[model samples]
Target: MKKLLKYSAFGLGGLVGLMLIVVAIVAATFNPNDYKQQIIDLVQAKKSRTLKLDGDIKLAFWPKIGANLGKVSLSEHKGSAEFAAVDSVKVSLALLPLLKKELIVDTVYVDGVRANIVKYKDGTTNFDDLLSKDEEESQTIKFDIDGVNVTNSAANYSDEGTGAKYSISKLNLKSGHVALAEPIDLETDFTVTANQPAVAANAKLKGNFLVDPATKHFVAKGLDASIKGDLLGGKDVDITASGDIDAKPDTKEFLINSLKLAATGQFSGAKLTIDLSAPELKALKDEVTSKEAKVSLVQEKGSDTFKANLVLADIKGSPKALQSSGITGDISGVQGKRTISGKFSSPFIGNLENLIFDLPKLAGNLDIKDPALPNGGVKGNFNLTLHADAKQELVDSKFDLKVDSTQLNGDVAVASFTKPNIKFNLNADTLDLNKLLGTSSAANPAEKTAANQKPADLSALKNLLLDGKIKIGNLIYQKYRLSGLNVGIKADGTKLALTGLNVKLDDSQIKGNLAISQFAKPLYTFDIDIDRLDVDRYVTANTGATPAATKTSDKPLDLSALKALNADGSLRIGSLKYGKTKASNIRIDLKADGQKLSLNPLAAKVDDSQINASIGISRFSDPIYSFNVNIDKLDADKYITKSDPNSKSPAAKSTGDTPIDLSALKKLNASGEAKIGWLKLANVKTENVSIGLKAADGIATVSPFSANLYQGNMS
Candidate 1:
């Protein structure tokens, strides 16, 4: 037994020695060029067209023992061309013996590789038609890579049909050890591509990967990168970046850690770099939408947390994802509301710092710090802030839009702005008067000579005038669209109180109040009084009323040619002027329910020959007027023969054949009432010196309404 055991041991030793020599020869006799054929044969075995290998290789104990490579890249595409590049890669134990309708690769190590796969414009790829039946049939690959690294590798993918494109750049996955029993378990880099406009970036990742062998699930940590870019056409921007992310596929979610960015460059032209960890991009977006998002320094332990400013809203990017949007604005002492989502964004401005939110369709509240939205060619709503001087004077201003497309309620259309807290409310169910005002402008007379009678852009009218507190300007009404209507606005002292001011777009003028607030007591109202106002120039724009071969007047005043279709005819109340007396608080009221009007009593100044009418015809918008008072007892001789017959009557009065000396009334003493109708001035007499009278357009008429005997001959 001893002898037999000894012989067995010697024989075993001889066999082992022979095996060792063979392995030694195989391990040391490998030719570098032979690797090409070896890889080709292996790839061919799997029916693959292109086989690329790189990185150092190691073999131990000869061909029968084991062979290993540092790192290698394995890629596949379907086309005539091919693409290849490599970094550290390794593989051991070819496992040729394990081939039987299967390929079981053993011992692999890969690190730091860069590769690019491109789909050219001609509907072809870097590797087209490069797959064989066996490779095509292989449903999965198993990898046990100890170390792998990829950096700054980029690839482009384009569609053959629509010419759409996708790309990845600056991709890097380093210092990671992973195993992929299935394809999806493969750990890779995140990057940004030019083709994906909506997706600005996805970059930064590296570390260990424990992927589910069959389920293709993966978990990642310490993945981070920088992001930067503009979103809207120079109106919106996202430029600063840094963050870290961790992804766990089995849990179907990701987490964001240590993410931060700053605002520099044109927000429209912004750039960003980041070091953060997030499970998925969705989680990062949600973080941005938070009312108060916090981000820490990626590399520092004592970094300040930054909070986002100017919270707009964090609704989904699409319209259907949100039901409504709103905003807020405040200045000196005024405030108002409007629907931002349903109307236009041009009328107002909004303000936000470090963020340019140009919302063409964005809806919200709007309030420019400027007392009023600065007037100009600026389009749409934006962020704006305005400043006022110590003396309550307008100073610097920023015109940012706060709201977009805001719908309005029916009763209120627009508000006119002249001073802070002094916005005039205008109402027009069928037509907005302010909108029309905004659309009308008057060209300079030098630009509108006989050679250039055409109207210039009428919309700039408001821009042509001083914008501030009222300064007693002329209020002319002309060619009113409304029919048979009269309106007036009056003010007393520094206070303005509108009365009987109205507008009926298709017909006549309406009546309203013109009370303005006082400076010392902003809460208190004031009313103003106007002596005379031109009725024609206040209504129509871009128009004129020139006479055609004028004719002299022959008949007495008739006074009855005005009617209101939509608005009631009422005079804006003002003080009544008569002989030796002036009545204050004179106002005309037109009742809507009954459409009736009441005129303020009058104050008259009477004379013997002719009665001087102290009334003003402030009714009607056309070139017509009516303001004639009657004289009960007047001497016709004295009435017709005065130096100046109340010189205020050329266009407003109609004097009959028994011309009265209205010019003398300024020096005479008399008394009587001035009859006033809808738009008519009538009957004036002082003493009985009968002298019938008339005025332009018959706005003034006197019945036997004349002066007593005085003129040489009676009519």
Candidate 2:
């Protein structure tokens, strides 16, 4: 047995040595480049395409069997233009594994690969011929690769039918140990460009993946991705994401663990930063659920800053319907030197089938601060229920809000986003305009300024569509305190109407209806009535003795606002009283347009005397005034102020010339006529009195001054 084993060993050694010598000889003498023409000819004959080999073909042996090809290109089918090209490629194989019919690759190195792919108008791809299925079954071989490296590769794709094009350039991909049903580490960097939406971006990806082709199962662990681009109107955007993912199509199960995303970008002229995180998310069949999700966003523009944070728990949903146990959020912002903040909580429900979203119990607290506010702005709490319908583009909400010492409840609805129509009904206990606006009601009404002369801007009212009703128990404005105030407002396009306006103040009941149109050049029409108004309650009362003379402004009035004023109104008062004068059944009809104004048919009854008068003004900048007055009877004592016997100023009790300055009257152009059935002067009585006066161009004239005095007349 020893002799037989020795002979077998010797023979095997000789055979191995001879084989090695033969391999060395072949490697030395054989030139793979010499057969390039033959290989090209064969490819052309079988695939009907031109193949070009511009560089040398090299081979290696000993440690591994490898082949390296340089500058290779393939042309389109039956065409001369190149379809795909490669600068160089090196492939290495395990020699021992090949002997057992097992393919084991060490590493693959590919560089400078470029390809253009196209889908024609007929939905046929450029590489359709290459993808044709083989008619006969092929043997399946098991293969493994230790690693793969690809660098400087690019691909372009275009769809002629859709007119869409996309390109990926500077692609570098590296992978480790790729095998069926085994984990593989991959890293890639690329730049992608698209024409349809006009976007360009650079991206990097790193991950470990396990894929099973037969079961269509996939798993990704430690996945990290980053992208930077000019994606928002050519503004810079950067995004980073990380997560672990598992998907099994056969079982319809998917899971994501520890998902985190962060983004920073310029959006709509504002710099925005966003962060999002999820602990665990799962999808089984049609049901999707998440343990908890959190999101935060911050925006900045100029001096304005806004920030919000939200947390959602127990999120469960399908594609068509979604629900959440609750949502908590906080919003804070600084705008116009003012700080505003709010904190809210609610349960959210969404139904995409009906395109509706609802917040059944939304509650919040708000705090606002501004230096201009009287009491440093307001702090409030509010409760609301809301419904939003996307299909109809409508939002409806009901709210109860309390701020300061006021309580307000309201229902608001808005529809049609493009041209909104709003409807609202509000009720409030009390509102103080002066306190809310940081203004004072004690400001003198006689004080005038150039700023106040500017025409009011009503452009915002041109396209408003609103119908609302407001009711308040008490309202305070200026020096007036109004109670039981109910106002109805309706507006459409350039027209606005205030109807059923009812209020009370200072022992008076007031009701009015007002309408305005052509807001840019407003035209107003109003009807107002007051049952009884004690004017003395609203006006400041004088104390002590009266002055002999009062100071008046010499500056010309700025009536430029009247150029846009157009109004027609009637005012009625059942009883009106001022100082010692009293009037009943007073009526005034007013009409004004452009620079002209008139109050005609001003009729009133004063202590059994019937008075009728009319006043007109024109050329508002340099005013012209005209008046006509008639009275059936007059008792001057009832309307005149009685002299104080204990006066301090000598001018107050003087009967001589008081040196009155008539300069203001000289500047005005005026004409008037007066007729009185009876007149009382210095405790003397006269009958059939008539007078006429005309003044213009710094001149004054008094003519036809006649009266029946003691059965005689004087002119």
Candidate 3:
């Protein structure tokens, strides 16, 4: 028995030695380089491309059954440019595994591989022929690869039609146990450049993947990726993401499970950071559905910080259909520690080509700081609701804000944008108009003129309507303090009306209504009533110009504004104080049309005397004015005497004659009549006086100008 075992062992050893000798003989005799021409000829006949092997090809035995190829290249069809090239490639197989028909490869190592692919406008690529397969060929062979490692590889693709170029460089890839139907582990790092969108980036990916070769279904687990690049027009961005992905190529359905991504970038000199996570997301073609997602963003620049959080759910469809799909989300943010929260939705989404917003409903609460206030800040809390229907061309919004000692409520609606039917109501406890104006005084003439200049192309006001009401408890405008101010206004295309405007000033109350028509050539009509007005005070407060005693210029006054104006207005004052003059129950009616203007029946009571006057002006360039005056019981001595009763009258002194320019009279055409019941001046008393005056073409005449002096009539 021992001898028989020994002979069997020797036979086994001899068999092993014969196998090694055979392997050695095959390795030494086989010239892989000699087959290079055959491989080139076979590839050329099959792929219609030229193949070149510039370096040696060698085979190895004993430890592993392997082959190493050096410097191989394939040329573009009918072109001298190389389509793909490789510096070296080494493939190894376990001899025992091969003997067992398992065909286990130790490693497939590919180094310095490069490919330049181009797609032309004719829908043909440089590698099209190489990638095409004959229909008659049967795919009956199947094999498994234990591992593959690729290093220092690059691929470039260019589309001639789109002028787009993309390249991947310094690519390194590693895969383990790749099979037709089994799971595989993969890791890759590459640098990419894209010309169409203009991006440059370095990316790394690590994942475990299961792929079904038949149905082309793929599932990825524990996938992580990172990219660093300059994106979005040269902004430096770094992003990292991890997720599980599943895809079915047949159904075109893809899903991501537990996706978490974080990014940091700089945009427009502001640092931005974003964090996003989703439990599950699914998509098919243009339709996308996602579960609740948590998203956070923070932006900071200098001392300003803004942070926001968003939770989204049930998101589906393309951007255009998203409006109709009705998205629901909660958004909250803090700007410098000012918290704001809102529920956002879009029930009826419309196409962006014709709509302002896909989902325009926003209802939010804000606790914010108002930096425009005088204090450190005006702390305010407000509830705002806004809604818009771009299809209907309407907007409706309302807000109620309360800050410190002030509260405001406003509701506004715009029925249409094209033909703008608008309505608004506003109420405020107190508002400092000066504060809102923010130190901006009245603009200079140049700015005002620029602002008032008519547009080169005017759009017609068609079907315009507006009705608004505003009320404020107190308003501080300029240097004037006012209270209980209310304004009601209505406007249409052709006319605008201010129905009720009331305000309380200092110790007086003002009430007025105004109407304007003929927008093309505006005409104004107003009726204003004031309990008492201090003209000097208002003039001093509003304008720096004060009344000065100076010689009147002979140059004609520029009444172009009046000539351009078309207006009819009436003003009434219970009492008015202008400088040292006091008047009561003053009423004036004014009218102007083109170059003609009339102030008829201007009546006032001054110092217990009643005065009535009528004035007319024509020819605006060099205006001619006609006036008729009537007075009853005027105490002239009071006005003519000096303020100091003890002061003596100075002796008369000769003064140069101030010649009056009658050039304006040439443009005048005026006629008037006047009468006085009683008049007293310097101890002279006159009663029952009448006068008639006419001026035209530089001629002036007074006819039947008579007065009863000391009870005697004189003419």
Candidate 4:
């Protein structure tokens, strides 16, 4: 038996030596580069594609079976356009592993690889012919790779059907020990761009990963990723995330532990930051759960800042339904001297299959502060019930809110996200604009003119559809106090109507309806009636002496907007008082039709006098005005300002030819006629007065100025 064993050992040794010699001979004599043309021809004949090998091919067989390829490219199917290219590649396999039917690979290096893939409208890809269609199942081959390093690789993909393009460039990947079902360290950096929505981003990822193709299981540990990009309509953003993840889609199970994500961005010059965290999250086909989750956000722009923080605990859900123990949050906003802070809490539940979500009871408290506000702002408490259905595109919310001494309750409902229709009903115990906005005197004519110079932008109202009602027990604005105010608002397309507007101010009762159409070139129609209104009550009295003018009042009026106006309205006041003048049953009918405006019937009764007037303005720019006036009896002194005799310093008495600035009238072309049955001026009395005025182009003349006085005729 010893002799037989020695012979077998000798034979085995000789066989090994022979194999080594043969391998050496083959390495010395064989030239892989010589077969390059043959390989290219074979590929062309089989796949109908060009194969270009720009660099020599190399091979090794001693320590390991390996190959080195440089600068190789393949053409598109049947076309010369390049589909894929590689600058260099090196790969080797341990020969001894083959004895045990085990394959082990050394570190593989690939550099400067590029590919272009395209899917045509017919759902065929450019590389379809290159892909092998194997119908028979193959035995699983277990293998291990020492590592892989890839650099400067790129890929481009385009979908003709959708007209979408995506590309990844400057890609680098490094990995440590890759094997099926075993953890492998991986790191990658790449830049991706997409043309569909126009997004570009640079991203980096590092993690220990495990994947099993057979079981479709994936796990990632110590996963850290970062991305910076211009996205979301060209906003610059940076995002970072870290977590441990396990997923088994075949079994419908997922887990994420210690997940954290942070993002920073800029939008319209505003800086925004968001942070989110979850301790543990788990999911299955039938169940999903999370430990505790938190999210925080902050936005800042100039002097304005906003912050919010939210927390959720014990989140549990299923594919069809979900629930949370509670959600708690706080929000704060600051703008200059104004600040608003609030806290809220609610239990949430949802039916995801139906796309419906509900918050049964949401309660919150708000605190506000502003130096300009009366009492330095206010505090409030609120409660709400909210419901949303994405499938139906509907949202209905009911809320009750209280601030200071005021109470407001409302229900708002919106339907159809596209071309939305909104309906709301709001009722308030009191709304004090005086406190919210601060009381102020009426604006002077100059201020009003300045305000009118500002352009109005109503484009957003062009597609609005709204129906709402508001009822307030009491309302205050500036010096105007109102009670029992009820307003109904309706809007569709570019037309809006304010109906059922009824309010009471002091001793006056007012009702009005206003409608607007064609928001771009708005047309207004209104009808308003008031039982009594004392204009003097709201106007601040000028008790001091008038100051001398420091500048000439020759500024031309900007009445272009009024000349473009299209309006028809009527105003009626049962009793109106201006300064010391009192009028009753005053009615004015106004019409503005692009080129002309007319107050055809202006009638009023003052004490024992009855007056009727008609005024027309044909040219608003350098206005041309025409008027006709008739009065049965008038006391002119009642319309004049009276001096305060008790004052230490009264207005200076006017001497002859007191300077009257007629520059305003120079541009106001006018023709007017007035007749009064009886008139009184200062201490003079006249039984009949007739006057005619003609002013045009900086010229003025009073013609037919006649009156019956002192038992004689005066002209």
Decreasing lDDT order of the candidates: 4, 2, 3, 1
Clashing pairs in 4: none
Question: Residue 642 in candidate 2 has what lDDT?
Answer: 68
Q: Write the per-residue lDDT of candidate 3 for residues 417-504, one digit (tens) a residue.
A: 7678999999998987544333345666555532222212211433559899999999777778889989898988777888889999
All candidates: CA RMSD in angstroms? Answer: 22.9, 14.9, 17.5, 10.0
Question: Against the unseen true structure, what C-alpha lDDT does each candidate score?
Answer: 0.37, 0.86, 0.77, 0.88
After aligning candidate 1 to the native by TM-score, how far in Å is the CA of 114 from where it should be?
6.7
- Candidate 4 Cα deviation (angstroms), residue 628: 2.9
lDDT of 2: 0.86
Clashing pairs in 2: none
Query: Please, what are the lDDT tens digits per residue for candidate 4 over residues 605-636?
Result: 98889989999987666677899999999888
Clashes of each: 161, 0, 1, 0
- Report residue 652 deviation for candidate 1 (angstroms): 36
TM value for model 1? 0.34
Flag the better candidate by lDDT, 1 or 2: 2
What local lDDT score does residue 256 receive in model 3, on the 0 to 100 scale?
Answer: 88
Higher-scoring candidate on lDDT, 3 or 4: 4
Best by lDDT: 4
Give lDDT: candidate 2, residue 299. Answer: 94
Q: What is the lDDT for 76 in model 1?
A: 57
Which lDDT value does model 3 have at 71?
93
Model 2 C-alpha lDDT per residue in residues 1-715, reported as the tens digit of each score: 9989999999999999998999898888999999999999999998888999999999987557999999999998899987899999999898887777778998899999999898999999878878758788766667799899999999999999989999999999999998878889999999988987677999999999988998898998999999899764546889999999998866657799998999998888899999999889887667878898999999999899999999988778873677999899999999776798999999988764556889999999989887766787888899999999988999999999887777899999999988889999999999876555554345555585444333456767876899999999987776778899999999998789999999998589999999988787678999999999888887777764554356566655555556666889999999998876788999999998877888898899987788999988888787778899999889887667666768966755766576766876657678998899998877878888888889887787877788888787767
In model 2, the worst 10-residue window by lDDT is: 448-457
